[model samples]
Target: MTAWLSVIGIGEDGLDGLSSAARTLLGQAELIIGGERHLAMVPDDGRERLCWPRPLKAAIPEILARRGRRVAVLATGDPMCYGVGARLSRVVSADEMTIIPALSAFSLAAARMAWSLPDIETVTLHGRPAEMIIPCLYPGARILALTADGGTPGTVARILCEQGYPDSRMSVVEQMGGPAERRIDGIARDWPDGRAAELNTLAVECIAAPGTVAHPRLPGLPDDVFLHDGQLTKREVRAATLALLAPLPAQRLWDVGAGAGSIAIEWLRSHPNNKAVAIERAPERCALIARNAAALGAPLLEVVEGSAPQALAGLGAPDAVFIGGGIGAEGLVDTCWRALPPGGRLVANVVTVEGEKTVFECHQRLGGSLTRIAVCRGEAVGPYTGWKPLMPVTQWAAVKP
Candidate 1:
């Protein structure tokens, strides 16, 4: 098919910033589709114009309907970098569309700050939660964030302070590539209410305050980081469970009977693209799971408040499954086992004798490895420190052939 759709990337400089090819396509287009701000850049020409509808995906059919005709869709910066082009490409084939390039916000922000693009972590807060920035808040890290609106900078600053990086340097570069380009700088702890421009990119130079505790994106997070009511996986056991589960990029995990959602959250923290769903029976624990997910920068973690086996219905098949509780629940393990595709992993940890028997039976039938993990911590006994043993855990891990 001839490329009838032209997805052009435009910067804040508007028409002046567009390439000759992008401009010619826009001039020849019969229908122009974009946000009101982007549409305003072009004077009312003879072409039919469309402002993006509520829930942007609603306009997909309209774009598809005019498939053979000249259609130009305007987007900010590089359309592939967290823009509408990526979403539209899923439905519109590359052969039918020509994607034009422009300087992305990240590129502009890095230039203004004199920072190396490859060294910084770039994320989008546009239509996403602020907590998504939490996982990227380590000391000496550089981040470039595309803000949702004017209020995002303050929210980012608040999160920085709460996460023990109060002394971090913050810079908001407003209206990049435009004549009104401006930069505002401040420390995260003392970030003022100087409302940033709507079209702005936030840059952060993460500097830890004195005595700030570092929480690296590793499997073994301290148990206290999660809010739990005794129905929690201890730190060491949780780490062991994650090690067996083996998180990878863009892989999804099903955390069955997620108590305080530690395992699922840790799985998400391991990689930005990793996804997890926490299934819990209690309503209060479900709410706590959400809190933990948001606090730990895994706001994308889905919390299903119901018992397993039935709740697992309609959920997308996972790359890995971790059964932390409900080992005695009928058909729960079987349901999870059957859902795995070839090479999928399943790990179950149980502390009780009845649960251990079930795991043992599963190992005998499934032909996988079994592991027993016992942890002991030192505690004060009068003037002496003695090792106190916690409940031992029996784990069964299998890879579907």
Candidate 2:
């Protein structure tokens, strides 16, 4: 198919920065589409122009309607890098469009800060939760974030101070590659006010205060860190369970009967692309799961408050499923097993004898491995440290063939 859509990555420099081929396409285009700021950059050229509507997805149909027409789209930097072009590509194939590239915000910010792009983490806070960056906040880490507006810098600064990285350096580079370009720099504790422009990128150098709590991005987070009513999975068993589940990038997990949402939260923490849904029957536990997810830097964790096997309906199929609670619940395991695609994984942990019996039967029928997990911690026993054993856990793990 002949390409009719030309997606150009324009910078703050606007027309001056556009390549000759990009300029030619814009001149030939019968319709131009872009945000208000981007649309204002192009002078009245007698071509039809459309500013993006609220909820950008609403414009998809209009773009599709003009699929075969000469339509030009203006986007910031690289359209594939958290830009409208990426979203459009999902509905429009590569053969139907031409993409012209420009320097991304990450590249421009990295150049200004003298920071290496590969070494630092890059995230977009535009139209996303500020807490989404929490996972990237660690001592000695570097991050470049694309802001939604002027207030995002202060919001991120407050989060840094609250997370014990008060001394972290914050630099907001505004209007990059343009005449109005300027930058504001300070520590998170004393972030300068009213300096960030609406269009800007924030750079941070994480520096933790002494005695700050370190939350590593590992599966076995300390059980004490989570708020639970003794229904939480022990740290050791959680590690073993996660090892069996084997989370891969971009894979989705369904944590049935999630208690404290430990497995689901840790799965999200393992990789940014990883997603999870915590299905719990209790409303109070569902609320606790949300709290734990936010605190653990996995705010994207979806909490489904209802009994599983019924609540599982309408949810997108998962790459892996973990049943931590309700192991003995009738039809729960069968429903989850049926939901799995070929090569999909299922791992269930149980501590009760009845639950273990259910797991044993499933192991026999499903042809998977069953293992016992046990852990003991030292505790004070009459002024002497003695081993206090935790309840042993029986785990069943299988992959749908």
State TM-scores per candidate: 0.96, 0.97
Query: Once all C-alphas are superposed, what RMSD does model 1 give against the true structure?
Result: 1.5
lDDT by residue (1-401, candidate 1, tens digit) is 99999999999889999999999999999999999989999999677999999999899988888989999999999999999899999999999999998999999999999999998888888888988898888889999999999899999999999888999999999999999999999999999976799888999999998877788788889888899998788999888888888898999999999999999999999988898999999999999999999989999999998999999999988999999999899999999999998899999999999999999999999878999999999999999999999899898999999
lDDT of 2: 0.92
In model 2, where is the ten-residue run with the lowest total lDDT? 190-199
Instruction: Please write out the lDDT profile of model 2 over residues 346-391, one tens digit for every residue.
Output: 9999889999999999999998999998889999999899999999
Clashing pairs in 1: none
Which residues of candidate 2, in runs, are more than 4 Å off?
192-195
Give residue 197's error in model 2 in angstroms: 1.8
Give the Cα error of residue 203 in candidate 2, in Å: 0.6
